[model samples]
Target: MTNQQFKSTLQALSLPANRSAIVGIKRGIERETLRITEQGRLSAKQHAAALGSPLTHPSITTDFSEALLEFITPAQSDAELTIKQLEDIHKFTLAHIGDEILWPISMPCFIKHQDEIALAQYGTSNTAQMKTLYREGLKNRYGSMMQAIAGVHFNISLPESFWQTLQTIRQNTQPKQAFISDSYLGVIRNFKRNLWLISYLFGASPALCSSFLQGRDTKLPFEAFGKGSLYLPYGTALRLGDLGYTNSAQSALNVTYNNLDQYISGLKSAITTESDLYRNIGTYPDGRLKQLNHNILQIENEFYSPIRPKRNTAPGEKPTEALARGGIEYIEVRALDVNPFSPVGISLEQVYFLDVFITYCALMPSPDMSTQQQQETQENLSAVVNAGRDPELCLVQDGQSISLKQWGQTLFTDLRAVARYLDDAHNETHYVAVIESLQKAIADPEQTYSGQYMQQVLNSGLDNGHFVFELAKQYKANFAASDYSVYSEAEFEQMAQESDQQRLQIEQSDTLDFNAFLADYFKA
Candidate 1:
């Protein structure tokens, strides 16, 4: 789309129209940092201060030292940092507690195709091939669920039992894998560890859960952990399918109360059946999918609590780690819809827009306010998601209400300024297209993938098979056209083949001992 066309599209979305909200960080100023260092991993002085003897649950009595909370006074002069700017700190943290964060089981398995339609279009039918395909599909699907959870989980209450699990492990010996080199379980371990770190790092409050968990009382309520996106499991997906996107999960308490255990038990189910329902496309009959759906529903029902470090004065189990950190340097944009059309899964333009948005968020002062303000912010977010294309949707900023199109336009104007600054500092012109696309999305929401999804669904009557087929076609076409250096179509196909062979080997192995594998898994 042309710049003029994009601009015109923005005008109708009711977003801010000017450049005041935009703040750009100079390029070469260290956008993001990643390091796994032991040297600067929480200074001895800081750790000593931060780790004052652990607090008792529900009533934290600190020695009034800096050790209890990783507090940052507003006036303290830490240099302003962008989300990307924290890469080094993140890396260091990862290295310090790396193995704790990886969760291999969370990794999606591939589903190979056997027939020509499945093989030619979707790749091979071997276990590895199917697993690879499953992973891609799982990433996109899981990504969507996580995005949803991110928006609302912050308000959910974390349960004490879950928090205790991590704390128990942490106070004990450090897992050998946590400090090992070349750890294959990096991602999952990192995520799990970080979940534990929050209480120590942020002093997260259990009070946050009271409002959402009041009447239902299904043990600990859902918190910001998996509630947003990671909540997928079999039963939950079924519930989501039953409940449209607009309604909150809290509405369906009765159905959940009836079969809670079945739903929870199903979390580990594997989708073993291979009916034609999931033949060529990425869909599968794996019981695991059902379990994932169930998990999401269970979360929606507020059964699962996010594990957090311990806090005193709260009537819950303490997390192994006594404290957690909060205070956002940058909000992780967990909601990227896999552009089934893009080969690398996302475009340079998307990345640029993300960079621009995070910078904008960093520069803007928090819009903190009374309950009313929080409500307004929630409404604005909902509008952006549900009524993004309504043209008349309005958002509030600085005490005044503006149409979303106007707001978007104003935001992008600031974004453009940031992009210009970025270009000058980094000598990078890659962000220009992304800035242009944002401009277009604001002016005409229809240009967005969300809008496109709506259009296709409406045109095709929401047929799942057709929806997935078209998605595959879009992705394949994008793969053929783009020149992303990392993952080529040929490489992807080869990976699928190898994955299939591996699965077959495991299935046909002579000394297969499922019970032994289970024993080892739980023992660790």
Candidate 2:
């Protein structure tokens, strides 16, 4: 699909009968943040019992560390509602966790040692043990310091009506689910190719406490700030870089996204393959079962990507199994750093812009990404991570080198067009307005979140710890002072109780020993 062809399709979608199909476009968010003390340290606490079980809770759960809270909102057609739900979760959480404040940024707070970060615990059911064991494997493979880095995942799915309209527009004869899966794969490919823009616009992890480096030497040309602070002068999102929540060992695995089967098969191969490095780590270190096995990947979730095709799984279903069973239900965008400026780590304008960008990705024609092409995309991302604000920086596309400004202009033009169609469909002006506002980010790199936030850090002369510590206090107070808008405190308290009961039921219902349960899970 060339630009002209995409325009024609947009024309078709703009028809009155088809445009209304977009009303059902669903989006959800999964935001992760570390629980920290008021003194700017990782909280030395378990997951708050008042918050609910980490296993059965639908809205709140712990991610890698017990102190790391993951807030989930149900998929909603309106982005505004999603933000509201996220805000309500924060309000509820802050009220429950006593004096502890949520880390308001992607990079973690000060840590003295890796042992201070405990693996997220989920009771004693076999399923719960499996979840904890997976974290243990992650700790053994990569240090826990990296896993403490936080991020936001935006999960989106086009409406059934929109897909039906497109299928009819193109006369696609494949089965409905198959067509949806194929189209979503195209979105994944395009998203990967254009992911650098996201890093430039929203990436905000430019600095961190020196402790995150774990006292190791770094190749990055980092400058020192007050006492323990370190930063790159032009860096955008260090969280997405090699130093934060990324898996370097999986770089050797060629995980392709050509089709559902190919993607799933590749992940399966990854988990099944043995690794001598991990084997040397000792799966049973001191006969205590440190990791699941000496495999290259303990499970499919360990294979990190900026974007992923997702489907709601049945009980005991693997992610790939869900995709294979019902095709792609949605795409989880893992590229975004937690927006430091927003109370909920995301904003309404940002969500509006995402709808435009995601729509453009789905509409664009995407060729199968060659291994070299994929490598170039990652190179572009790494470049942006370290020094995206440099005017001299260039990124390669289709074997041609281009300045970031020129490439960004091209993307915004297409994005603006998509935003207009979204306006026509959703009966709102926010989409195009968001495009126009964010378009300035391309013309002036300083308008980006990381660009602006880094200036504040430099000007304050306070250490990274005190700067973010001050900001976090404001967010904590805001959550505390504001009354719940979506769900009441009593309701949230009841839900926590319900979640605890559910976890207890699952524990009571366990029929097999942990060993037999693990064996049965692998068999599936």
The C-alpha TM-scores of every prediction are 0.36, 0.98
Residues 413-502 of candidate 1 have per-residue lDDT tens digits of: 766865664454445675665687557765765566555543444466533223434544443344334443333335434543454454
Candidate 1 RMSD to the real structure: 21.5
Candidate No. with top TM-score? 2
- The lowest-lDDT stretch of 10 consecutive residues in candidate 2 is 280-289
Per-residue lDDT of 1-524 in model 2, one digit per residue for the tens?
A: 48887888888999988888877779999999999987778998988889989899989999999999999999988777889889999999998898999998999989999999999999999889999999998998898999999999999999988898998998999999999999999999999999999999999999999988876677998999998999888889999998977887888887888888989888999888898789887646367778877888998888889999999999888999898899999999999899999989989888888888888988888789988889899999999999998877899989899999999999999999999999988788988999999999888888999989989988998999889989999999998889777888888888899999999999999999998988888777
Off by over 4 Å in 2: 283-286
Error of 2 at 167 (Å): 1.4
